[model samples]
Target chain A: MMGLNKKDTSLFVVVIVLALLAPFFLNPFPTDSSMAQFNAGYPDLMQRFVIFGIFAVGFNILFGLTGYLSFGHAAFLGVGSYAAVWIFKLLTYNVLPAIMLSVIMAGIFALLIGYVSLRRSGIYFSILTLAFAQMSFALAYSVLSNPKFNLTNGETGLQVYANDPQWLHRDSLPDLPHLFGLSMRSTYEMTVGGWSFSFNTGYYLCAVILILTFYLSIRLFRSPFGMMLRAVKSNQQRMNYTGLNSRPYTLAAFVISGMYAGLAGGLLAAMDPLAGAERMQWTASGEVVLMTILGGAGTLIGPILGAGFIKYFENIFSKINDNILHQWFAFMPDGIEDFIVAVIHPFIGKGWHLTLGLMFMMVVIFLPGGLVEGGQRLARLLRRKKSDESPSADTKPAE
Target chain B: MGILEIKNVGKRFGGLQALSDVNLSVQENSVHAIIGPNGAGKSTLLNCLVGKLIPDTGSVTFQGQSLLGRHPHEINQMGVARVFQTPEIFGDLDVMENVMIPCFARRDGSFRMHAFETVMNEKELVEKAEQILIDVNMIDKRHMHSASLSRGDKRRLEMAMCLVQEPKLLLLDEPTAGMARADTNNTIDLLKEIKEKRDITMAIIEHDMHVVFSLAERITVLAQGTPLVEETPENIKGHPKVREAYLGEAQV
Candidate 1:
């Protein structure tokens, strides 16, 4: 809202209102119905909607503005998750310590990676980042491995036992710390008829922070710093000869994006009491790049929507089974239902990636600016058609 | 004492000698021009002065301080600003925003920091940037993106960006090289106006004799990376060595 245009400001307000009212609205759906399975309002997937949204939004700060395509940003995300988990083990299982550690760790990691990677520009820089991230992933897998109990636990992940103390988690403890030590985690449960909604304390906390981060990102996007970043992307030589050094500005943006990734990683562990090194994989890093490109890189809110869309499809489509497919096509004869299942089965199940890949290719090729431009084009086309039919009616501007 | 002094500066790049025993001294506030042929190393000398390249021998001193090992931005902070031959401006930034970068650099000093302060709310920075924009005749186009401006206007904006830094010495490397005759005249006028308003030293490299004769109080000529002559423009026009190296046949 701070720097948003009229349309974006309204859209942001609508999103916040929807996130708040989702539980109430979803409460009417049947408890055991398959439709409920598709509801993104569920805590596990809903948390991810905001978490990866933060990741993509942060990544936009670097690749979107500076044109520095980093292939190893996932390493920072993984570092953040590891730092957050370590905080859970040593300090309090509270979300605050985890978030703080994650940010600091990510910043340090970015500083190190940025110092070296920034030495080279363009494709070489991207390769440097990728090599560093792969090294990190390998180190995490081998060095942190345990013979008996896993430290990082490798691909299996490290989960916090309930016996572990949640220092600032109020719901987990009756007599939590007071005032300065007041717990931020507060859960409220509500039931309507046969439906129950577990309003998570952590989810709201993450949503509030994500909103704040989003607002900060918007400010960064519009500020002089943002202008400098865009200039660097446009022409580094021009910036250099203008008596400005491009390195420091690009580095600052990189560090800030890394901090945001760290914040997201910390939130992930907070929502679920586990941290996995798998989160830092190259593929995981590539996913955010895909999300940004598919949603329209450089446009605000596009990346977030892209994150939500990808996560939603991944969750919903992966859950589709033969039985569900057959049930949906049951209106046809039994043989027809079986035949339809056979055709749609591979595309929906294990083959979900092929569908996403095809969609990504189409979006990249046809709508290079992503869904945002696509939507704008559609709106313009419809308006043009209407204007042609009634020319005088379109005299006034749409704004 | 000369504010900027280059004593016996020489540089070699492997097999090629770019500059050899080149000595230049600029009095505190004078407009000095360097005229040279294609490979005479005028730009190489300028690069040494601004710390883009270090000389193989001799010392470059500005305000009695060595500029040998300092970074270009640091050299700029030391009050030496350079304008490229081509208009070097932040294309994505507006005219005023283009002017504001030097203000931020001069005010903040450090190139990169997580200041996290309201960059636009810096009152002094905004006022200085606006004032400079007015000086450059770009006040009306303050909100226009620099890339969209005409070539002349882009050059003006770049000049304004350097001027706002309030450098003790300004360097222009072939400022009007690609400009049309009209644009070249406008650029000369802009430089004249800026010189009248600011107390500054200037070292300029130019191929155009008309622009150089009109603006430069004193001129230095170079041939094959070695100084041919340094004299007043009137004397330079008549000097035998300067004429032989550059102007002899052209003045026919």
Candidate 2:
């Protein structure tokens, strides 16, 4: 099963099936029905889901396995996006080169940043990364967007323009972000009974990348290098005395994860040919942290689950307005109905952060292992119930 | 010359001199013990050998190469392995994995990506690690998490981790400190077995006289950051200086 052991192979298969069938699975409601707003089968959001899933998976390599909390991952992501867009501007609208350059550029930046930041550990390491990300953000926003030499193109963002020298661009190729003639935003709509689904070229591309990257991450987790990273988290003193340098191990992880972030960022730019300074902001860095923890930090599938969970919630929850809340609570008495809507209002729409905050806190406090732990507990409970129904449990003494 | 040599080593921390004018050498294939009471600079001397602390004066050399200014990992790569007072096994890793770490470090220098190959695929390393586990009588607990093991088991795991490296010089800092009498005896037997089977040189620092007398071929008594006497266990037994250092404890 793709060189993975039994458990990892099964998990990989599950993820692959989910990624390929996301459009159908996400659009579980009729298009004209009231639940249509909850449907997340659209191409744009689906691409985001896989892209951020890749980001969290990469971040977990450093933060989850090595216990190095980096707060500047978005800098690499932003750097990737900028590199991709520059490729579009300088070379062509084709995404292949953009994605490749993005990874390489991000790797170079990560080498520099990681070499400096990895000198410290714990909160100081986190602060060092956060400071670097903020500096990158500030530079991208103002300093690098100068009139004489514009690298980031300032607050307006860097985008492909008609006047730009896209030397490789031709009349036959699609002007939009694409692989050759295949446009990224091109979608095929199919209706089965009351349900409608969109299978997008871009989402599938992102899905393929996600699946490949996810498999690579699994290999990393099972490799000797992965074991070393875990040792870095467990006991650095033991690791050092065993003739292994913790610094190089962590730096390599940092660079590798940075490249993953770059891959994700390139995908984002490929989906939409614009790289904005906001993409490099600290909030964006923090979002991936939330995704990794909310799902499970060290587990292979946890980050993907977490990314999907946070992105899905962010989309659907933010769409809910006061009107929607009032409609849902209309069955109650007049005063109680208003109170119910008022209570729910703060958790939806513009107040989505409150909900995310609450969920993050609950995950950290009760489910320290995150959503994966919750799923494991459920599986254990179900197993217990099944065993209890059988005579073997009562007849057998507890081990 | 000895495998590891300390020439007039000195170390200071703020207002206090932790160790000063210390000179000693651990001969090849012998168990050398540095025994002293609390705050007697025994641990500081061990730290200097393992690269944890750099002496302000004099040199610490291993196999004729200076151990000074080198990182712990670099020193370890030069065939010097250390076991801590408290069993500093990788607590989060399982038993077999804990032992295999030093094996990996031994096989693959200070750093290697090894990003793709599965650990199980390295049959050679796994077999070597398992063999060491067998030698330590811990093959049955190979799959168990190191943290869940009893203190005695943890110490054994730590010992296995060091021994798998087959270092030229093995530094043990109070290897049986805080152990129950039965556990201490087991450790002594383990050390004796290890000595019988290997060509390794051991440097042990202990406060327990029973442990020192049981394993040490040579004993160095330290008092107030200076060596009082360096002698064999038979000669150190009735030495007046040893008696004074131990406050007339008949156990010496």
Candidate 3:
């Protein structure tokens, strides 16, 4: 059971099954059907789901367990992406080295940031992290992108160019990222009863890494170190008095989470072969925080669910247009349909963020534990009904 | 030599001297009680011992090592455990977890990377934690969230947390500060039982005369950041300096 308890083992198995069958399950709608646009089986989007899942899972280690809200995680992610892209430019186009280098680089960055930021706790800690991230973003955007010695390529982003020296790469090899000639973009397509499913090699690779990291995260969540982190969150004063140091534990959690973000960023570069300074923005950092909180902060599965939920809404909801809305509501009376569309228009399409904001507010107010708590509440209610009927069933048999 | 020694430890905050030339010694395996009126520097002295504050002058040492510049956890690792005035148990953790943390700290020192070791797999730690909980008479409530415990139970749990460390020196700041008579007596009895069974030194600061008289082997009365008298409980009761400093009245 990979050191997991029975319940966690089962949950792990369920996630494996879900990830394995995602292509088939996600592409449920026929190609020509009106609901085809809702299908999320595309390679690009699926890659995003697992990549961000890794990011949030790492974030949960720090914020969920240690209760240190880092407002600059995206800086590590950005650093990872830049490291990955630089690896692609100077070294071979193979993703393994790029991914490894990105993780290491991000870990180093996180260690520096965490060391300074952890000296302060509460909102002061958060502000310090934010300041560091902003400084990193500014460096990447301008200072590091000077013409004489450009590390990042300014606004155009860092990418592989034909003239760049890739020492490990042969001229005959394809320029795109690959695993021993199996191109990351390679996909296998199948059509069954007018429904098409596409399985991309890159997506599967990311999915496998995500599952491994998720398993590691689960182990960490149940470990003694995890308990120590929780104790830090609960009462740091007591932790210190109990002969436990809080700084090293918090810093370790920070570095681990930062590495996760780096892995995610490396995967992003592997998929697109570009690293942008925009990835380091505070808004990007806020998105991951929203994902962690909206799913449930402390729970193992909550962050993944939150990341997927937000990304799905971001992609699918933004695709909605007035014409599509009008077509869906055509069955209703013209006046009523127009009125409904007008009312709903602002919350969809480009305004999908408004809907996300509203949902986040609702979750914070009604379900402080996030969607996981909501699911648990539902499960409890169902269990209660089953228990209530069991006694009645026994009485009926006696009668 | 005593296990803990403080010599001429003075701390000044602006114009007011919080603690001025305060000297105290705590012997091994003895219970020393420090009693003081409000703003009498008892807390400041305790903070200095636990490395929460740096005295402006003089040295505070435990086992012949200076504790002046050490961090709180480092001070704790040197065999000093502190109990706060209000119970400082981890409210979010269970009772068992609250006790187990100190056991981990004791076994692993200040910090160890036990990130991958499942807590359930730590059989020895679990046994040790359970044994301490049993000693504290809280084994039955081990699974309960610590925050749900009554005030007295919280105090017991906090004491259990400190005791699990098996610290050589225990610093308790008013262990029964806000408790009723019954709870106070329960705490006193628990401390008495702990003292009987363990070869530990304790430094207790208290306002309650009943608790001080019942538990302390040596008593120090502090007034306006200076020790008025250091004597056995029987002698401290009739000492004129203590009576005047405490009651503002001259002995007849």
Candidate 4:
């Protein structure tokens, strides 16, 4: 089905189902309930989920398959955002062209960086990539944003101002980033008694692209090219001696992944119409790496899960302020409530990274295969317990 | 001229000359074995032929084409498959995948984008890989990880990977180098069967006289980066130059 084997087909379907019904799945708590603070069905947060999901998925194609840890992947994402915002400023506010150009620009950037960076392997390659990304950050942050040729517009970021030359802009068209007249921020709020779900058009568009990219990723994973990438990771000497060029194969993976990051960057701009130099920061790259590792690096759906996992925590968990904590603990005795709030203060809201870091470390130490491995282990354990009556129900080797 | 011709291939590394004033020819369809004592530059000569090292003095050609200055993959693309001293199969891949990769290399010529098509959907390549595995007697262990395979099986898998490419010239750098006596015999038998079943030329570097005498149709005794004698295996055993090259280590 869809060029995938039965196992992959089911996985693809699961992603589609989850992505399409995210508003419901993410908004399980009632809108009026105290737990509604944790709900992530808002248009802004939902867009971030699918956008970052694309970024991590692309990053995995390089880091996961070929075992090339690119420390500057966020540069591609930043470049994509800048390219996208430039399109919005020069052309119309339409997202299609912006997304396309962002991908192409990112690919070209990847080619240049990968060509030089891939000459060295292991930690050297990583450092090379990091250097390139930092250079890109410097270029966007100051060098390219001068008054004579204001491309990135310095630290203020590049956004569609009232006096910009949007050649395709018209009275009939939406003033914001959109597909035709359908604005990305356009959301349909649905209320079911005390429960509320927000279905945003922008989120849906990003979700569809995410699904398409996910399918393409699956195809690439199963194709001969994918096998060759794995071969590269395993042993380059064997690959070269077998009459296969490993350099071009790795370059291709790097470029494809770069394009994915760019597409994600374009989506981010489309959602908010702003491209900042901070997107190109090294911390952003590290965050994606953490996401990939936390969710499972090599598995097909692991990156998407990882991206969503991190984004959800970043948005929802970080919103838990002292006021909200105190409100929740108001029902308790005064002394006990204050003690509990004080104890939990460091892991909530502003200290959300502390929570995230602790979880990431735990996942790394215990579930080295990431969240997907944890799921598989749980599934196996359940199956074993269910079939304990039959002593012959031994564990099967992984296919 | 033979299919592979080497003329005055001298290679120097800093002060030491690894291979100097070497010349030899491996004819088509003949198993030519180059035997020598340790540090006799046997491996260096093989490396020169496969473009792993560039000779300081002369020419190395396969099928009338020069092998100098070419990359390893480029050398491989010109119908030369090399088996390393230790089996260099793709350890991370499965047994089937280890064989299939060479087929892809042979068909695609180094790099081709299979971004859309699935690996299993490549029916002809899959069939070819399967057939090669069967020939190597590894079809039963096709699903096993190549790394987990026994040492003998790794050698066989490496052979399958090379053979699937259908190269005209096969280079084995001590193919039976760290094997049990029984496994060595099995490899010898496998090589014999491969020689009988296919139209291929082999250039083998060996320390083991048993393997050299059994498989080599023409034997070249190399000593101090030079070939002292090139003759039939029978004549090579009797040659005094062969004994002198071996420093009286010859039990022939």
Candidate 5:
């Protein structure tokens, strides 16, 4: 309530409830059922959902509020991941320090990049960010992978080894990333009848972080700074004449979003304890953009929904092979089933990217407000219909 | 010395000389009007005053400080506010928000990190913005999106935005460029009321003789990127060079 009005407070509560109940909601299908393949309650995938949700939320701060699309957010995320891994190797296996270090490191990187990139706006700003991210990726891949430094560890990725210093680590504890003694990989499973739900310590940690960041995002969206950023998006010219210097506002938003990406990246490494240079690649940046836009750029919940939708399709849809398709279509006539499979084949499996593109196109064309707008429209229509019928019936009784 | 002084100001855009040897001085607490035909460099000169463009020659001094090389927002902080030919209110914000931005600037200087502060909770700013809205006769439409306002209301809102800042020097670029006669009259009345209520200096550029003759205490006529005459309204109306510039012929 500090920054949120009633509506925003309700939205925040709804997000908290949804996140807390995700293990049950996402794993609705029974383990023995054929539909279990679609279940997203597993530790790894659930962790990704929350992690990328954090990524998109951070991205929306800059893109949604200020309308400054930086195509290099993944660089911050990658730096965050690398920082977390280094903390694991030298400091300790405890994730709190690693995550803290990652966020700070990422903020520093973002400050440097935002300072230079914010000088030129529109497409020029985007290009500058893109160039900086590419340079970071190249440096991480080759230049930082020398025998003298070996910072990123080249293509094989950077991971904690048994021989690393880990000066703060105790010999009595397990060599995995943890919060004190609680292992990130620890899980608790519950079974009821034929259904089972497994909740991971790591996934819950990510979920809790995601919820906090989401709340912070809501606060940012409703704050005066948020209004200034929107003003920057609306008309920078008017802002200047109104006696506002837009550069510092835009730069702050950029750095804040970058820190969010870094937190997400740190979480990624905290879950798996590895950092890859590919995480900083431009495609990863594009993927987060897609998540933000596909979910709805300006809305709070749209990005999380978009990220979940894409990751779900990527993991589950791609697992559907010809044999699985054939199994599903076994009841049909041979020729027709084969034809149906052929038509559906290209858009699923390895063609999930194509499906993602098609879905993105349709969303942009029809639901430009993303899924959130679509939901609002549908709710309005339903309310209109209900009100229309009730009012007509009441008028008939009066007549 | 006048509050704002322009000395030998000249600017060229490649082949076109926009303003050449344009010298002008705006006295404190006086209404000055800059009237000229198309491409007479009125806009070019105004742009120079506000830091939108740097003059090739001469310096623009406000309160004896050079306005050259200062950013637009810097000039604004130095008690100079500008209203564009077309209203430049923040289109995405509500009318109240549009007014409150300038109020924030007035209170907070050019920039401040009020990121965590709830705008709704800023009681002082809200009251200031609402008072300005009432003064501008837009209190009823405070919640409306600025872009959706009628042209007259948008112009009124822009004026309110500028007035909220309590700027020392208010530069208006054709404040009534496109308006119905009644709306233009309303704007004139509003400007008159503001001038009466505040010790503010105004420099207006206009093509409307009604607006210029009604509001300006002093008038400067620019012709072919040069100031042809600077005189009081009565003297400007009877000036031979002014009549020649408008009628395209010198009268005996």
Candidate 6:
């Protein structure tokens, strides 16, 4: 849990390679093929995959390290999105200001919340944060909605229109933001052995930022600040008695993680150019907690894996209908296919969450360390079995 | 003025008087031990010294500066660090990392926001922590998790955590409260070693007479939220008031 072991480092490398190569290797069907239902190669879904990955990764920094169960984290993400949207409307449409504003705003929000909430630990802290988040949600829906509709654009949400200033629009820019005069929004394509893939410019940008954020989180996880957070989590009283103020350390972690959420929100708005109040909903906030816990709370890469797994299931399961099930079971007998469809049909629409819930339960019950510990257990079992088999083979020399 | 002075400090929780007008002081670089029975408010006094509890009455002055209203970390930054009754080292962090935290707080006064520079690469902090670890004879276990150490070793690590700050005054609450004879002897030796190597003024609260007699230069006997006697350990060992206050009731 402290640092990456050799096996984990190799696994991390393998996972990164797989994530990069997934579009070409996993999605074999044409873009418009009926089998595209299972394909997560689309820009919209891929954007979500990374955006939520950032969200859960930030969350793991707080709940995972400090064991502070914050029920109001979504408020930070929502506030971040709103701040970013306002930046887009007021200033240029470039991502730099939007992201900066989001991070700063979220940090300020966390400072206020953490100042009050950190006074009490455990259930009290959770309740305090929950109440604050609800208060924010209420304000966003009620006051921030109609009167200053120009800022947030209210229930309709803020969206970019043709009339909006296009400072970031490449065709209009006198001197565009480019690497060696090449537009940042350019993509490079590659094809091999009847398989074609396009690496998206936006996706690459998101991937790069995520990697940087991931690196920062890793550095933080290994630092003294990180140690203080764990100290706060383990025993606040002891820490207080030890002439250490646990409050400031907890507040710092809260702000840093909140900034990450803001960055993610800004990136999401950059990809799609819309900021909706619904994005900051408590359910959305809870979704990242599920991802972090299901993946592995303390492990760095676990949250990303958790985010991808949940999003993959969410997209695939929600899209499946009875007709799609029938198409898959066309090769089987009518009786077996109908039985299988009947068993799975109820969990297709709103029921996709039921599957997520079951997966979360399994991960929690059987693998409390999340996917990271599960992987370690599997590796250990394989090594043991190998050693046992080799010894047995030597003993059977006569054979 | 005494280096670390407590004047008429009293604390009340509901109707219970945890500490009532308890006044004491330790001169610089002296080993001062505060002894009391269970629930005698020894910890409550230490809490007041380190700014954990705001006293209902009286003033706490460190080197003639007011200590009230300062946060614990700020107090630590101002050269006052405490080791807990229970060893409170960061369990997940390695020993070196655990020690490095106080060094960071001492140097920066707040968590540094830079994510690029490695904390270990800070030469002064690493050298200071390494030196403290050497003093505690825990240099060999510096790479291991602080939690993985034995009880005595955890106490040593936590002591190193405070020592890294180079505090003017240090506070210890029941530092050897729960230990076997061998571990207690080991802790006594470690404290003796640290005392000789560092110029730190420590106020230790102990239930172990052996530890108090072996380490403390001066002893303060606390009974019923008040200081009964403040004297040298030699004088404190034979005092009738202390004997009647504690030893008469127990086998000590």
Q: Tens-digit lDDT track for model 3 on B1-252?
A: 899999999999999999998999999999999998889999999999998899999899899999999989999998999999999999999998888889899999888988788996899999999999999999999989899999999999999999888899999999999899999999999999999999999999999999999999999999999888899999999888887887788556
Worst 10 residues of 1 chain A by lDDT: A174-183
Interface RMSD of each: 2.7, 0.5, 0.8, 0.6, 1.0, 3.4
* Model 1 quality (TM-score): 0.86
Candidates' TM-scores?
0.86, 0.98, 0.97, 0.96, 0.97, 0.86
Q: Per-residue lDDT for A284 in model 1?
A: 86
lDDT of 5 by residue, B23-63 (tens): 99999999999998888999999999998999999999999
Query: Candidate 1 — number of clashing residue pairs?
Result: 0
Clashing pairs in 2: none
Tell me the tens digit of each residue's lDDT in model 1 across A1-399: 365666757767766775666566534566777576665666677678888989999999998889899998888888888887776666566567778888999999999999899989999999999998888888777667777655687777766666766454555442321113433345567766767686766667767887878878877876768867877887776566555688888888889889888888878777665777778878988899998988888877778878887997898878888888877888999988888899888878677887899899999999998987788788888888898998876544443
What is the lDDT of every predicted structure here? 0.81, 0.94, 0.93, 0.93, 0.93, 0.78
Kindly list the per-residue Cα lDDT of model 6 for residues A272-380, writing each as its tens digit: 6677877777787788888899989988888988988899888877888899889988998999999998998878866888878887999999999999789878877
Per-residue lDDT of B90-143 in model 1, one digit per residue for the tens? 886777778877787777674655334445777888999988888888899987
DockQ measured for candidate 6 = 0.28
| C-alpha lDDT of candidate 5 relative to the true structure | 0.93
lDDT, candidate 4, A1-399, per-residue tens:
978999999999999999999999989999989788888988899889999999999999999999999999999999999999999999999999999999999999999999999999999999999999999999999999999999998899989899989999998988999999898888899999999999999999999999999999999999989999999999999998988889999999999999999999999999999999999989999999999999999899999999999999999899899999899889999999999999999999989999999999999999999999999999988878867868787667557
The residue pairs in collision within model 1 are none
Residue-level lDDT tens digits of model 3 in A220-299: 98898999999999999999888788999999999999999999999999988999999999999999999999999999
lDDT of 4 by residue, B104-202 (tens): 899989899888888878899999999998999989999999999999999999999999998999999999998999999999999999999999999
Candidate 3 global lDDT: 0.93
Native-referenced TM-scores of chain A, all candidate models: 0.88, 0.97, 0.97, 0.97, 0.97, 0.87
Better of 1 and 5 by lDDT: 5
Error of 5 at B2 (Å): 1.4
Worst 10-residue lDDT window for candidate 2 chain B reads B243-252
CA error at residue B33 for candidate 1, angstroms:
1.5
DockQ of model 3 vs. true complex: 0.82
Candidate 6: segments with Cα more than 4 A from true spot:
A1-19, A28-36, A84-120, A147-149, A161-198, A235-244, A327-337, A385-399, B247-252
